[model samples]
Target: MLKEKGLFGNIGVQVVIAMCVGTLVGAMMGQSASMFAPLGSIFIHLIKMLVIPLVAVAIISGAAGLGSSQSAGKVGLSTLGFFGLTSAVAVALALFMGVVFQPGVGVDMTGVEGMFSNVYADKGEMPTFWATVLGMIPTNVFQSLNEANILQILVFCLFFGIAVSKLEKERRDPLINGVNAIVDAMVWMINVVMKVAPLGVFGLMADAVGTFGFSALMVVFKLFVVYVVAILIYGFIFYPAMIKAFSKTSPLKFLSAMKKPQAVALSTASSMATLPVTMEVCEEELGVKNSTASFVLPLGATINMSGNAIYYGLVAIFFAQMFNVELGMGAYIAIIVTSTLGAVGQAGVPGPSFLVVAVLLAAGIPIEGLPLLFALDRIFDMIRTALNITGDAACAVIVDNMINDGPQETPEPESSHHA
Candidate 1:
């Protein structure tokens, strides 16, 4: 018989209750609830502290385990291809939804003028494509880590990991073991920090709702609806279809196994934090091989951001529509490409909403609209993080099927011995 889960045992239940209570408190107390903002801020900071090391070590360890450069290259290419394809499709779907729904219509923009002006005043020039690519190559690795530039850190880890894998066993074994130890340590830290997730989420929700109240929510309610609809379609429809089409896996079975990891993702709102759970579910529940799960899931955590792609596309178009900026064919295409690429480069950390800045700048949408979106970001972050992990697990199944020729078959039960 399965053991019953206690109140504290289910983090999802705790977080949901916290969100509801926080919203109620915020609605009741208004600005006074803003006092709780620091609680959430501290939680976010704790999560961010792990991002750089966790990403670097995860990637390094995963790459080092690929056994050969050729195998690494093949898996790397296939993994990136899957991420890129799914992200592009997600962005396209979001764009289609944005155009069909037109979520920004009939919206009030009265108090937002000050925010727009402030952000506009501080807006820097958008970087060129080549310059942006060049920026990924870090001049100083330490500086990149200090600044938490994920793309730069990713580039460094890729090179460092590949180089390490080339070393003879004598030299490589120690480095590999050391990196694995660090990855394990970081995961342990994640578990410890996640213990306070309920309180953290409570503070975040309270502050968000308290400060903005219902007005902000009403203004963007349509956009929120559109975003939720898109997420549902992608998570329920797109992912399952892909899994079945590629691997003949039962969609119901896959989603059933994903429950725990999805819960963790929804509460933490950070893919990096949810990585360990995702890996566990993929291997133990879904029966994905460890070698494939280890390599694909970590890389997917870094790059496979289907949910972010959708959000970026939707937000860029929403802002464009709100600003009455007419987008040409080229502009729409740019939105698709830029949003997909932006999601690719986005760090798997909390507060990924900031990465939408690049999407807006690329599409010539005003940066001032970001503050408006920021108000609703936390709720969306939960949804998107869940989708991100789902996509990761699904990709693992597909890749495993391709590389390993589906799951290994279990031997028939041995005849009972009748001594």
Candidate 2:
């Protein structure tokens, strides 16, 4: 199901080609390549169009069905706790590596001085972590839908789905069937939109490269290299180890099964845009039950950001090293806490990350040189989104495996997927 027949039909190959060509074109044309940004925007918008509805439908269907599980509450809590734990681990790793490697030491600040700004400082004070958690509840669900507040949508759908589950069997079955049919419809729409992924990826790469260029990277090439290594360590090492330790699934098999969704994540750079594909691969390819895939994947796509956690931790260390500021024990704790929670608070949408600002301030690091990283965030976003989806899949696989071992009245959470 993940494969395409001919060479040209392979969307993954096509996306890679587009990414390369777009980077080349951007380098050649410079800021003029900004014209292609609309192409990327259109694709993202198309994907966004389906995300809210797909999430709602899938969660409703999954939760309603999972309502039958004796340990359903345990399943949901475990998934949340797993993400938070992994993110915390990842940030701790990043901080350790940053301190050991010191990629930010002896940096030139000549050109970096001009790009620094305080405008983004206000972004840090927007919402405390508790406030963001509280805000997940929808005051008006219709308003939540209109605003596309995913967390609120998730909460509302769970309440609605559980209420439906409590209804008479005759009533519940019909509504579940209806919601699932809509799930299939949304999946089809995502498929249609994905055909143009190459065009959209090209635009995104061009705009990001054209505007940012590689000049800014020269000063921080060492940091970029270290950043990539940290990402690879988490993506390949930590995640695979988790799969090996916790699930019957092979690490190689789980990684190979992840290719299609990872490609989409790379091209689109939005975990929300890639959710449908993630759900599909999780259920069909990895043998994750439909219910586990639905609930865990959607929640993971929204909040699980181990990669971002790594980035935040490293960046905080990067700045501290660059300034020769000694980070005390308290600073390290602050970095870990802030980065882990900040990454968790991140929305799945692909955009320049402002959460890094909050991490820096919380740890008392200066935020002066952040614009350089902001320019490079698109590339970073692509990489991290892949990690996010991988985490989503890992959680689903492990959680599904755990549920299978538990006491259950109904073994199957739903009918066969893609039926």
Candidate 3:
């Protein structure tokens, strides 16, 4: 009976109800609700535990499966290009928000220790750009895997897959085929993990509701509205204009097709978990080729972070504002640059990224301001996850267009979305 309603139907329903109930009960009791908080934290950890392996194998396997390593570079570059474009826009929007809203005025909060306490600027004897590039070459594959350094793994897979694809049919085919088989197995394991995502999400929701209740909800509501407005305007209007200029597909049609996956992304609040559905929507619904979808979607899911980028900037500015931290022009630039880079560097889980953000705050910045938002992170996470998926879809369309000779004939007219 429960299965018939769907995993989303059951788990999503439970989570919302849990949040509402927890919030109501906590409010009545005149205390922060602790019940269900542990469950939620555990669920978040479980989802996080799956992220490292899932990201590494998914990228490697996705890259190698693209037929030749040469094409893999093409896909990787396209993916990076998409990420670069969206991230830049995100930072710009954040800066604009900071300036227009003047979030950094007359705020005060006490800084915390043992957390992110410094800016990501002027590290002593920093490596050169070329050196940083070279450093991506993993010395030990297993070491990279253990550390879950996605960029390094992606680098290895692109070149290695290209080499395998360039070999004689007998040798290359067997090797490439073997890697695909392994990737498939890993994907299956990821699916098994996702089966419990609702439980995780539910626990996360319950804890957040119990702890923060009404006041946190109000803050989250404000943040959500602001961020969603930014993402929607940029994703739907600005991005579509860019797409129309560069690609043949209608942007509205493109976005309409992605709605189902986006909905799932919003509900789950995990880009990686929503990937399988997003990939399907791109291929079956939007007519993106399998190679394009596989190559673009996984990479996007891992690194392409429009929502995270914007959140970093806005949150940083917001925190600085709350703490009455005066960020001069140089400091503002540093915030934008560091936040953008950190989005790439701290690419695994939401929690770890905060640690990176904490570093930004520790540098005589506004670390104390961050805790003000912690109570509302989960709510913002849902919207950000949706925006992340939207960026993925947009990239898929752009890259698919770039690779194909031109546009294919349009598909039959029908309602574009599917659940």
What would the TM-scores of all predictions be? 0.88, 0.96, 0.78
Q: Pick the candidate with the highest TM-score.
A: 2
Question: How big is the positional error of residue 70 in model 1, measured in Å on the Cα after superposition?
Answer: 4.7
lDDT (Cα atoms) of all candidates against the true structure:
0.80, 0.86, 0.63
Model 1 Cα shift for residue 90 (angstroms): 1.2
Q: What stretches of model 3 exceed 4 Å from their correct place?
A: 1-33, 45-50, 67-73, 103-135, 216-224, 355-364, 406-419
**Winner on lDDT (1 vs 2):** 2
Give the candidate number with the greatest lDDT. 2
Q: lDDT for model 3, on a 0 to 1 scale?
A: 0.63
Candidates ranked by lDDT, best first?
Answer: 2, 1, 3
Better of 2 and 3 by TM-score: 2
lDDT of 2: 0.86
Which digits, one per residue and each the tens of the lDDT, describe model 3 over residues 71-124? 555666777877887787787797687667664454322232222233333332
Model 1 Cα lDDT, one tens digit per residue, 295-360: 788778878899999999999888888988888888888888888887887767777366687777
Candidate with more favorable, higher TM-score: 1 or 3 = 1
For all predictions, the C-alpha RMSD in Å is 5.4, 1.6, 5.9
Backbone clashes for every candidate come to: 0, 0, 11
